[model samples]
Target: MAGFWLGPRAAMRGYRLFGYDSIGSTSSEAMASARRGDAGDVWFAALQQTEGRGRRGRVWESPSGNLAASLLIVHEGDAASVATLGFVAGIALQEALSGNLPASALRIGVDGADGLTGQGHAARLALKWPNDVIADGGKLAGILLEAQGLPDGRMAIVIGFGVNIVAAPTGLPYPATCLHALGTPVSAEAVFAALADAWVDAFELWAGGRGVADVLARWRRHAAGLGSEVAISHDGQVVRGIFETIDEFGRLIVRDGARGTIAITAGDVHFGATATSGRT
Candidate 1:
């Protein structure tokens, strides 16, 4: 693992950087840092992750060559900003890949099959709502957020990101693609550095008290499922609807049967049969 402790430098800049060579999960490590009263923006980056996970406690493949890191942020922000964690991570990942694949317009895509690659050199990477990054219609990266309160009544939000940089694991539930398969090769350090810079910018923007509508607008431009039939599962009820737009609080607006339109605040959203579906 690599250590890039900017210490007072980052602390003065409002972030404390802590890196590890190997760990069970960067999110877990960042949580540990939070428990020790390491407040503010604490970033834990690892060279290799032994036990990385995503939503629903599913295993997240984190080989040595991929990027695994988590950021612990103690911020005074509303729940809306906190809930839009995926957009922040998605914007960051998009920018990070842009630096490497300058010629290719790196847009987000949904995953269609596990271990599937785009035909020829054209890579179709899509962004799924709430925080799944898909490539060639399969999962490429996932963002998991965990937040807790501090002794001072502040909130510490941990943003964990696992990206498939070098290779995509074979035999997954859905189709998975990697940067290597897309013909873009990058070192782990380079990817992490780019992501860190991008994430810092994204966090600053979100923390500035801007409405989530702007973020939603940006997401829609790169979004893959607008106007598409989808299934939103929340609170043990699965509602099938046409994806209309994103509401003010970042909830997905779905036009369901006779219900007119329903807003989904939290759940696993999957594209309906018209396109393809994947686990949340």
Candidate 2:
């Protein structure tokens, strides 16, 4: 087992650690650990994943040299607390990465015509609310939080994280970008080290009665969709609106005039320019 840290400040806070060299899917492995009743902060990490997964049952491209890991946290709080996992993970990862580089230089997105950075005065890396990390309009990392219904009227959540460290796969469902594309090289060990610390910090906040509102605020600070016109597709219906806030329950609030303000709990949100008319 390789080394893992709870945080830069705190030691392991009641978490039992599990590390692996390689696995089929970190999410699957973490969920298994939860099922066995060993459910503190368990992390499943591997140098390579043979069969990784993403949202909507999509297969994640988990080639070698990327970060494929998942954290299984047993629900001890309410449903809202459980749902904040994704937002927490996103914030954690962002904090971890920011510590390594200048905030502006670390921002993820496309280089302009003259390869100049955008006009955000404060160094900003936007997020695709709920579960995506974007820098400059391209995908930096994707997150999927799955809950397994236990027999005893309980559920275990597995937070799966796929980050492009060395490379991002081409010809995928959505246009993929990696840290390398931005001239930054991320190592697996370094990524894991920062992630572990960030997770502990995020969960601690949730445990302290911060609620989803706090998560929403942090997410919006780094979100890619705020104030932008976008389309959200779910169950064959499409709604286009100016991206708005996420409510306390973690639902997206979209203002589309005719539809008023629609709360989107689940859907594929496509930003404009790259926006699709509907789901593929």
Candidate 3:
């Protein structure tokens, strides 16, 4: 990773890389590259993102020493098919982090990610539905997916990863943790180096939507709050229920007492105690 070269597998697949010490947003850069007709299959990574954004237009902080990366793929297929890549990304991020985390954090399971310490104890790692990696209930990383149509009936899809390697943002609605905070201090570059390669493994498993079932299975194994109390806020309505399994297409399915089975296409999800906190 001297010059941000990806893992051998990625390189073999002809994937390219562009590294920056600071940038507005790696995802934005990826789309720009696509717009310029630069054949995709490239990753744009930056150490700092001054104008990063999260799902639903939330500001994503990417201070120096954190990892902000976006992978652009020039894809020809239905947009629905490409959406499954989000799960693929969660799997890759988990695999990369599990490989890079301190052995102490590689225990049977990580219950939460926030305010954790590596004080001679093991931790569990899990994925919060859709696009987040967590230790216990604390958020360690997040994913954002974006797509733009090209004139050739194809699309430029960018899946972005923002990880807290050295520092986590403050005052978020939920807890945020970083490698340093977990006592497994590591450089953002090192994380990206591992993540770049891990993406190859997970992406291959996905096989461009053909193997999504397997991806979904792996995702389920590491999913958090699957059988826990949950709340989803959508369009001024709050749906409270048990965190049921995700449907085949990856939509979250909630089992409500009086509402039968509810399939949530998109919404802000909260779990356990937070679900009843009257917040979206």
> What RMSD, rounded to one decimal, does every model reach?
4.9, 3.7, 3.9
TM-score of 1: 0.82
Task: Write the number of the candidate with greater TM-score, choosing between 2 and 3.
Answer: 3
Q: Write the per-residue lDDT of candidate 1 for residues 1-280, one digit (tens) a residue.
A: 4844442333556665667778899898788777788855767888779999888788888887787879888777766577787687777776666566534544444422111123334335556777877665666777898888778877788889888888788986456767777777776666777777777766566655574566666665556567777877766777787888777777788887698998887777677452334344
Off by over 4 Å in 1: 3-14, 102-123, 234-236, 272-280
Selected candidate, larger TM-score, 1 vs 2: 2
Q: What is the lDDT of residue 25 in candidate 3?
A: 95
Q: Give the worst 10-residue stretch by lDDT in candidate 1.
A: 111-120
Whole-model alpha-carbon lDDT for candidate 3: 0.83
**Best model number under lDDT:** 3
Tens-digit per-residue lDDT, 1-280, candidate 3: 2245587778888889999989999999999999999888899988899999999899999898899999999999798889999999999998888877664543323232222223523235677877888864568899999999998889999999999988888997777788787777778877887888899899899888899999998888777777777888888999998888988999999999998999988887788677766665
Best by TM-score: 3
What TM-score, to 2 decimals, does candidate 2 have?
A: 0.86
How would you encode candidate 2's per-residue C-alpha lDDT over 20-97 as one tens digit per residue? 666799998898887888654677776578899888888888777778878887775656667777888888877776
Give the better candidate number (1 or 3) by TM-score: 3
